[model samples]
Target: MKKIAITGATGFVGTNLEKYLKRSYKVRTLSVRYVHDQIFNITDDIIIHLAGKAHDLKKVSNPQEYYESNFELTKQLFDAFIVSKADVFIFMSTVKAVADKIDGVLTEEDLPNPQTHYGIAKRQAEEYILGKEISKEKRVFIIRPCMIHGPGNKGNLNLLYNVVKKRIPYPLAAFQNERSFLGIDNFNFMILKILENKNIASGVYNFADDEVLSTNELVQIISETLNKKNLSLAIPKSIINGIAKFGDLVKFPLNSETIQKLTENYRVSNQNIKNAIGVDKLPNTAQQGLEQTIKSFSKK
Candidate 1:
């Protein structure tokens, strides 16, 4: 079995990936962090770099921490991968590295103009990887995944699930916007397929579920999973805005920033990755994957 070394092995995605890859490849979790001139000991045939400073939703994180952890650490690891015997290098980048709010469907062809420190740092790492020259034998995949969710994910999806479970009516249905999400199963499938197929080439690929769903649609999915009636109120945007502005003063969870995040258009296209992986459809449909996620909530 080909040995694979995964950084950030304790994270949600990394832990899942380590379990998934263990079925075929010999997988080992590597505990690594950002340190200047840090030399990595990588004896595995494949290196999966999943460690990075995630985007801080609270805006309290030090901006420089993002650069050090996301950019500098990735640079150090990639440098090691290039010189080591590893033939495959997979970097887990985010769609945020491209745009904060995508007007249309985000694709690999879109010009990257990141707005936050997290995005800018990741983009810098991507640029550094792309600028380097590697031999034909090596494969480097810069994967940009959007809003990844699974059983272990404790993101906004969990919050939405809880709201639906409590039978709280969704009030922001008026803000009709589509967003893309990636299921962890499909994400694992994509990574495995890329590792198996050398013809996939070394390039940037955006990964998302085949279908895009609106926020209303997501609430419906959560409701359906809980076997409850979905009640979505099409409250006017102005009313919601006023409430959110008031929330900002009292430090409520439904503040202006949270409301914007709760309803924003972040559609991403998985065409390039699907075409490269030679798959017409992923293993899990968008709804199926979402239903699975919602069901996991009941177990907790």
Candidate 2:
């Protein structure tokens, strides 16, 4: 079996990926504390870099932490990969690296203009990798995945699930928005395909499920999953905005940032990656994947 060395092996994605890939590849983890020279010493045939500082939703993390973990650490690792015998390197970036507010379906061709420290830092790492002179023998993949969810996921989706479980009405149902999500199963499939296929050209590709879901539709799905009636209430947008402003003043839960996150349009195109991987569709539909995730939450 081919050997694979992964960074961030203890993370949500990394743990799942290591388990999934162990059937076909000999997987090992490189410590996050390792320097560039230490990374270069690994004898793995593939390197999957997943270590990075995630976006601080609470806005309490130090600004320098993102740069150090995402940009600087990736720079060191990529430099090590350049000289190492690793034939494949996969860097896990995010859809936030491109744009915060999507005007339309986000494609791989879109120029990056990341706003937050997290997004900006990931973008810088991506730029650094692209600017390098890679050899023909090596393949580098920079995968920018949208909001990822699965059995272990405990993100915004979980928050939504909690609201539905508690029988709370979804207040922002008035805003119709579509967003793309990447299921962990599909994400695992994509990486395995990339690792096994040597003919696929290395490039920046967006990863998302085949279907996009509106927030209201998502709430309905949650209700269905829980065998409960949907309690989504469509409040007027103007009223919601006013409430958000009040929330900002009072430091309440329904603040501007939370509202934007719940109603943002973040449709990402997975066409490029699908084409590259020689697939017409992903393994799971958007609804199927989300239902599975919601079910997992209920068990907890």
The TM-score values for the models, in the order shown, are 0.97, 0.97
User: Which 10 consecutive residues of model 1 have the lowest summed lDDT?
Assistant: 152-161
Tell me the lDDT of candidate 1. 0.92
Whole-model Cα lDDT of every candidate shown, in order: 0.92, 0.91
Off by over 4 Å in 2: 34-39
Error of 1 at 253 (Å): 2.3
TM-score for model 1? 0.97
- Please, what are the lDDT tens digits per residue for candidate 2 over residues 55-133? 8887999998898899988988888788888889999999989998899999999989999999999999999999999
Clashing pairs in 2: none
Residue-by-residue lDDT tens digits, candidate 1, 230-294: 98889999999999999999998788998888898899999999999999999998889888887
TM-score of 2: 0.97
Off by over 4 Å in 1: none
